[model samples]
Structure formats: structure tokens, C-alpha cells
Target: MGVQKEKLVQVPRIENGIGLMAGFDIRVIQEFADESLRATSQDDIVEKFRKESRQFGFDYFVALSLCDLADPPEDVVWVDQSPKGWDQIYIKNDFQNVDPYFAAAVKQRLPFVWSDCLDRVQRSKGVAQPTHDMLDEAASFGYGDGISIPMLIPGTHRGCVSLTGERPDLSQGPRHTIHLMAIYLFEACLRINKSALREWKAKEFIALTDREKHTLQLLGSGLNASDISEVLKVSEPTVRYYIKNAKQKLGANNVTHAVAKAMLYGHIEI
Candidate 1:
């Protein structure tokens, strides 16, 4: 008998209830102890996601323009606020002090739902009423409500994702949905960012000489010069010579640095 045709499974339409005025942007930032050790091409990664977000109905998506690895200031205007043309406002008026969303996101390391901004007086203490006025101004631009999700990589503090929109009635359900999407988007971005970093490091290391490359491979394998000499059938002095030359070519202060650079460049596994 012919296989029975399977019935079409019904799929429920999951509505986020987020209108055109609501949208999100994810920002990933990582800092290596050595500035040279930094990983991730943030611009390329952001561009990649900006394209993807369009398929998901995002009205607009942007990558935060990061200048340093330091955690962004709590009230940095463009860093926290949404709505077109805020970049000019942030730059011209210096709205950092009055932006509540940015302050809450950095301080709490939690998402700042738009509804949370309703407690105006309590949230804007000490700051000038102008700051509150600035927020009210932003609300006029379809950003009255939103959420900011802090994306913390294990060793980093500056990574975060911000979701914003004009939906005044964004309840727990839509909030959770946006939060979940932001988490997934940020996770993917992290992977791509790291991969790009590794590639760049590998390219930089690949420019080493043949002798340097050999020395790095042996060192990465945990072999001493004497052991390397025996393995490569060269004299101990010759092995030491090669190691020294490799270190110089790699601009390494020591054998350890050479090995680390080699591993970073995909020249050696160890």
C-alpha cells in the first residue's frame, strides 16, 4: 500500500504584538588583557546581523559604535537611547545625564523595560528635569517603551543588547519574547565575532619564517630545545639558534610568547 499522506500539522501564529515602532539591536564587546590579544570583528558581525534582523521584521537595527573596551558610561546618549536622529542629539546636547534606560541597563545589568521608565521622578533623582524632558522627547520619537539586555561574556563587562519600541502595552509575554530573541541573536554574534578574531590572529602569526614556524610547532608541543634537536636530528646549539631566530621573527619577548602567538595563528595546536 502507498504510504498514507501525513496530515499538515497546524502551526500557531506567535504574535509578539510589537509594531513597526518597536525594534531591537544587539551589541557585543570583548576585551583581552593584551589589547593585541583582542578577538572579534565587530563591524562585520554587526553588518551580518543587521541583514538578518530585517528578515525578522525589525524596523531598524544598529551596532553601537564602540571606541574603547571600557564599559560605556551609564548615560551616554547614543549608547542608551533609540529613535532616529538621536545621534545628533547625543552629540550636540550631551543627553547622557538624562537618559534613564542607559543608566538602568549598565547599573542593574538587567533589561530595562519601557514600562519601567514610567516612574519618572523616582528614576531621575538628582539629574536635572531637562534629563526627564529629554526622555519625554525620546518617547515622542516612538521609543517610549523598550528593554535593554546586558550581554555579559564570562570575562567581559561591556557587552549588551538593547530592544526598544513604541508599544505602550508591551506586557510580560512580549517582553519575554523579545528577551529570548535578543539572547539568541547575541549568542550567534559572539560566535561569529570570536571566529573572525581567531582568523585575524592566525593571519598575523602566519607571516613567521620557516625556522620560526618550526620552533613554534615544537614549543607548542611542549618540547624543549634539546628534545626538538633530537626530533629534528639537529645539534642542540643549532636547535637553540632556530628557537632564538623564531622568537625574534615573531616579535616575542620569550619562547612562551612565540608559542602563544603560534597557537593563536593556527600554526600549532599546543
Candidate 2:
């Protein structure tokens, strides 16, 4: 239900020759971070981020927020600025389920390099073929190398902003700077997207009936339909009806998705 993942590491800048350039780039990261935070639109933020990425050496990118991947790939909001052809193929192939980067994000707590995805592929049995194929196809699009930064905004849904294609000389400076940039880009877009969504009327969002709300609350808390029926002294089918109605009201794809949407829209607290 999250974005990119990898354990990001920051090491000392002690290289006599290369350290200078790395130091300069690392410091400039703060400058971009400032600009990103104040960005009001997805386009502006992505434009600035892409320009900066080229300066550091990268081509394609994907900024995504996955609230619950169990639903469908298109269920979450994502900023996909990668090549046009890649998007079509990727979505058509249903590759998200097998993408190593996404799998890593679910388990990893740190930003990771592209190679880390391969490492994950190697560790998982029978998964190597799909991972390899995905990478092989991505390489055809010139996105053979890049960085993945899984973003976590406390109390918010998990997200990721990634830079793909071309390699940035890691020895140039603190790798954490890359992670920081990825996070800033994702967050800027999040704010812009959310601002539009925040205009939704609270009354319309919480259209569920009292019974529906209670049913959803219990469901979100991990109670099953049968349990809820017993607790409410209603038939199992009646409980299902309420849950189904709540899912429709929330525009959710499943039980978990409905729960997440209810929480996000302030309809219910979990």
C-alpha cells in the first residue's frame, strides 16, 4: 500500500577529488527542497524536479501513492511522467503485482537504489523471471538505472517519488540528498492533489447512515460481517448490505479500501 523502498545510507564526504562536487550538489538540495514545498501545482513541482534530476543525471520518474494495492493499480493517485509507451505497456501488463520496487517498498523502511530491487528478486524464489523481465523491458525504454525513494508522511498514506534512467554518481555526495529530493517531489504533488480533493463537502462525504457508519467502523477495526451481524443482532445478509452500501458511499473497491477512504475523508476514524 506504499511506494518505493530502500534503506538509504549517508556516508562521510572524504574523497579528496570527487567530494567537492558532491558537497556542492548536496547543499543545493536544500535550495530545491524550499522551492518544492511552496509549489502549488503538480506540473510546476514535476518540472522543477525533472530539471534538477537532469542536473544530477536522471531521465524518467514516477511519483505514486498506494493506499491499498490490493484493489487495483489505477485505484491510487500517481504522477507518471515516464515515457508514454512505458506507461501503456506497464499498466496493460499488470506489472505492479510483480514489480520488485513495489514489493520492496512494502517491506523496506529506507530509500533504496535500483540494484536493491534486483537483490529482492534474487531472494524470492520463482519471482526472478518476472523481475528480470520487467527490468529488461524497462531497460529497453532507457530506464536501466535510477533511484527509488519511498516516502512516508506521518499519519498519511504511503507514497514514493522515484528517478529513473541514467545514473547519478553516488560518490558525488550524501545519497540521502537524493532520498530527500524524491520525498519533496512526492509531497509537493500530494499537497496539490489533496488541495483539490479537500473541497469536497463534508456532508456529502459522510452520507452513510448511522447504521452504515457503525458497521463500517467495526469492519475497519477488523471485525468480520458475521461478527458485526451478531453484535448488531442482525442477519449476516443485513450486515453485508450495510457494508456494501458503505463501500459505495465511499467509492471503495473492497473492505479495506472502504475503510481507508472513510478514514481519509473523515467519515470514520480507525
Candidate 3:
């Protein structure tokens, strides 16, 4: 069966302030978080995510660890619940080289729908023809628009949780809620694979103020100090001060290093 696009309608925006979870069902998010915290194994996390994904209209998902891997690695933390035979075709064609979603995942820090990223990539110069070809092939297997939540790991490694189907909710409320869930699920995956957590050894949890954490998150999302200041409605100097304070607390050599450590320590979400 071929995938079908869902017609989107403009919905009234929920009037919730930033840093609040007023629009979505907090109980459901909390329940998922509690369940994720209790998950002791990779299988547990996978099962939990699978069950919850359907609520948002996704039938297939891939929780991938993107490093220097040219091919899929044999690791427990990497979960692939994508369509059957998609992997075989992906490997045969070396689609990894031109997979637009993977290309976007490493650069993006927030959850984004596939079409948005694809459109951006298409508009860019020097885009490969195979990128579009690969996506068309995916649609042949009932894969259509989906969401990819990008996670910036401590080291060079990045992570992405993508949910795909013929049609899924693309509204802001679901996007925001899924971002929260993806954070917890990624943490569970890290917990299941102890080897992955070795380098991120336990240290005294440096407490960062809410503003500081929010500043680092915006920074991680590729915002400059001025951009962050504008977003937070603060002066540029205040934004720089928050970055400086966070850097000192994390004992980082620079702002980028501080953001990386903050992500590693779970002090902020990107």
C-alpha cells in the first residue's frame, strides 16, 4: 500500500507560556516518564515506546545512534522498528550516504517533521539526486511524512528518534509533547547500555538555574547569543552572563564545551 498525505488544517494556538506544559496532557507524559524510568532493559524501553507511539499516529519508529557509522552497528541501544525490508534496500543502495533525514538530524537539535527538513534540503545547493530518489523509494514501502527528534550526545555521536507512518499528527502540541517523551526514552536507552554511559561518568550534579539551562538549550539549537537574548527577552549581556556561569559550573573550556557537558549531565534538553 502506498502512503497517503494528511491534509492539515490550521488550529487555534494554545496560549501557554514558554517553559510550561499547559496544552498537552501532563498526566500521559508523566505516566510515560515514570514507565521509562522503571525500564531496566532496552527491550523494555522499546516496548514502551512502541505502545506510546501509536497514540501520536506513528506505526513505525527508529531510535538511532548516529556516530561515524557508515552502516548500522550491532548494538542494543540502537532500535529499528522501521518497515520490513527497508533495511535491506537501504544497505544495498548505500542510502546512508544520501539520507536527507540523517543529514538533518545531526545539524538539528529540535524535533522536526520530515517534509520540513526535506524541503529545506531540497532548496539548498548541491543536493544529490539520490536523496529524493531514496525518499520516493521509502514511500513505496508505506513510509511518508514523519517526525525526527534529534538528540545531541556528549561526544561526536548524535541520536535521532524518528516516527513514521502514512499520516501522523503534525500539530505543535504533539510535537512539543513528543519532544519531552523522546528525551526520557533516550535516557532509558543510555541506561540500558552501560558501555555507552561509561565515558559520561558520574560527577557531582552541577545545579544550573532554569534560565541557564534554557540558555544552553537555545545555544545547542544553533542560536547565537543575540538570538538567544531575543528569544528569552533579555539583554545580550545577560545571555552572555548565563553562558559564562554555565561554563564555569560545568568546568568547560568554552561555550560549546559547556553545552556539550550540560547535555551529557542532563542539565538541559536540546
List TM-scores for all candidates, in order. 0.48, 0.61, 0.61
Who is ahead in TM-score, 1 or 2? 2
Clashing pairs in 2: 6-110, 6-111, 6-112, 22-172
Candidate 3: segments with Cα more than 4 A from true spot = 1-23, 68-76, 195-270
For model 2, where is the 10-residue window of minimal lDDT? 67-76
Q: What is the overall TM-score of model 2 with all chains considered together?
A: 0.61
Which lDDT value does model 2 have at 72? 36
Q: Per-residue lDDT for 1-270 in model 3, tens only? A: 438566577886867664464336778889989988888777877888787777778888888788544454444357789889897798788888898888888888888888888778768764678887998899998887899999876743578888888887767777777778888898788777664454345234677899999999999999999999999999999999999999998899998899998888878778
Residue 76, candidate 2: Cα error in Å is 5.5
The residue-level lDDT of candidate 1 at 46 comes to 46
Q: What is the lDDT for 213 in model 1?
A: 75
- Which runs in model 1 stand beyond 4 Å of their true positions? 1-58, 61-85, 118-127, 136-141, 201-270
Provide the clashing-pair count of each candidate structure: 3, 4, 0
lDDT of 1 at 219: 78
C-alpha lDDT score of every prediction, in listed order: 0.56, 0.75, 0.81
Lowest summed-lDDT stretch of 10 residues in model 3? 195-204
Per-residue alpha-carbon lDDT of candidate 2 for residues 1-270, written as tens digits (9 for 90 to 100): 348565577875777665564435655788888988888877887888777776666778888885443353432447888887887787777778778787777667787776756766667664667767887888888876667777777756677766776565444343566677877887778777767566455446568888988898999888999999999999999999999998887778999988888777777887
lDDT at residue 217 of model 2 (Cα atoms)? 91
Q: Which is superior by lDDT, 2 or 3?
A: 3
